[model samples]
Target: MYFVKKSIVIVIGSILISLGINLFLVPYKVLDGGIIGIGLILNYLWGLKAGLTIIVLSIPIFIIAWVSYRDYFYNSLHGMIISSLFIDFLKTNDSLFLINPVYSSILGGVLVGSGIGLMLRFRTSTGGTDLIAQFLCDKTGINVGILIFFIDSFVILLGGILLSTDTLFLSVITIMFVALTTSLFTRNVVQA
Candidate 1:
């Protein structure tokens, strides 16, 4: 029962993440942080596949997880792979909702954040920088959400520098929503 529940959560979470990216973020070229942000950057710059890029970029992070946190490696590897596959398979050219970019960004962030948060609650995650954040959380006694926020903000800054002023502004908003939603979801749960 526990394994089934975890699998369901992972699938739902992966779907939400993929939908948010394809339906909202990709349309406006807005970004979420961490590996997703890097994936988006590469997608924008070179038409690379974001899912594939995420997998490729995650290699070193997974190695770290394998070495230091064996449980995390097992917990998150499937979520990460599933989410990446979902992302590559589901493609959308433009915003399906026809909302303005600001609203679009907010919704996108919410969905993505919710997905990430849901899996996290189950002790499974879409490993990327998330793996690093978890490791740090275990080491420093700091809240994982705050660590995610800082890492996300750094990525947003990178996106801003590499992309456009508009992208910078929108990405900042996106990451804020992502952080808030993620924190809310994880508020009462003891980190796993």
Candidate 2:
């Protein structure tokens, strides 16, 4: 039962993440933090696959997780791989589902946030910078959400510097949604 429940949650969360990326964030060339943000920036610069980029970029973070928080590493590794693969494989096939930037941002936030929350509730994560945030939270006594916000903001800034102003603006919006949604989703877990 536990396995089934966890799998279902992972599936739903992965789908929401993919939708958030494909339907809204990627279309606008926005960036989020962690491996996802790196993937977006790379995608913008070299027209690479975001999912592949995410997987490739996650290596170092995963190594960090392995060294610092083995339990977190165990829980999140699968979520990260599945989510990245689905986001890359599913979203790349089409571009017919675009929506308004504001609405997309909101929806993306809600879905991604809820998905992340669910995963966190199960003692797992989306597995990118999340592990780093957890590591920082454990070591520094800072809130994970705050750590995530700071890290993501840096990534957004990087996007701004490397890309056009329009991409920078979009990246800001994307980071906003990611921050809002992630916070909302993790409210219960973080509180606990």
Candidate 3:
């Protein structure tokens, strides 16, 4: 029963995340944090598929998780695969609605953050840096939320340097919302 519930949550979360990226962030070229951010960068710079890029970039992290954090690997593998596929599939769809870039950033952040938080609450995640964050949190006794925020900020900074200042600012706003919403939802849930 627990397994079934978790699976359902993960699928729903993945769908929400895919919708956020495709309908809001991708249209504005706004980036999310972690592997998604890297994927977005690849998409903007080289016209690569963001979902494919996410899977490719996450390989090393997943490898690390498999070796050192077997439980996390098991928990997150499905989430990663499902979410990546959904992201790629949804990217091809037309935008659900058009809005200002700022509004898009906020809305995208909310959707992505809520999806991520819900999965995290269920002891699952989209993997990638999230796995690393969980591992580090376990080892260092740091709050996962804070660690995630730091990692996200670093990625956003890199995006700023590699992309544009406008992207930086907008992405910062998006990530702030992501971090806040994620923290709110994951507050009472189990830590990875």
Best-performing candidate as measured by lDDT: 1
Model-by-model lDDT, in order?
0.89, 0.76, 0.87
87 Cα displacement, candidate 3 (Å): 0.3
Writing each residue's lDDT as its tens digit, candidate 3 over 47-91 gives 998998999998998898899888999999999999999999878
Error of 2 at 150 (Å): 1.1
TM-score per model over all chains: 0.97, 0.89, 0.95
Per-residue lDDT tens digits for candidate 2, residues 15-38, read 888887777777777666667888
Clashing pairs in 3: none
**What overall lDDT, based on C-alpha atoms, would model 3 receive against the true structure?**
0.87
Query: Taking the tens digit of each residue's C-alpha lDDT, what string does model 1 give over 97-129?
Result: 878999889998899989988998898899998
Off by over 4 Å in 1: none
What is the TM-score of candidate 2? 0.89
Q: Residue 86 of model 2: what lDDT?
A: 83
Relative to the true structure, candidate 2 has a C-alpha RMSD (angstroms) of 2.0
lDDT value, candidate 1, whole model: 0.89
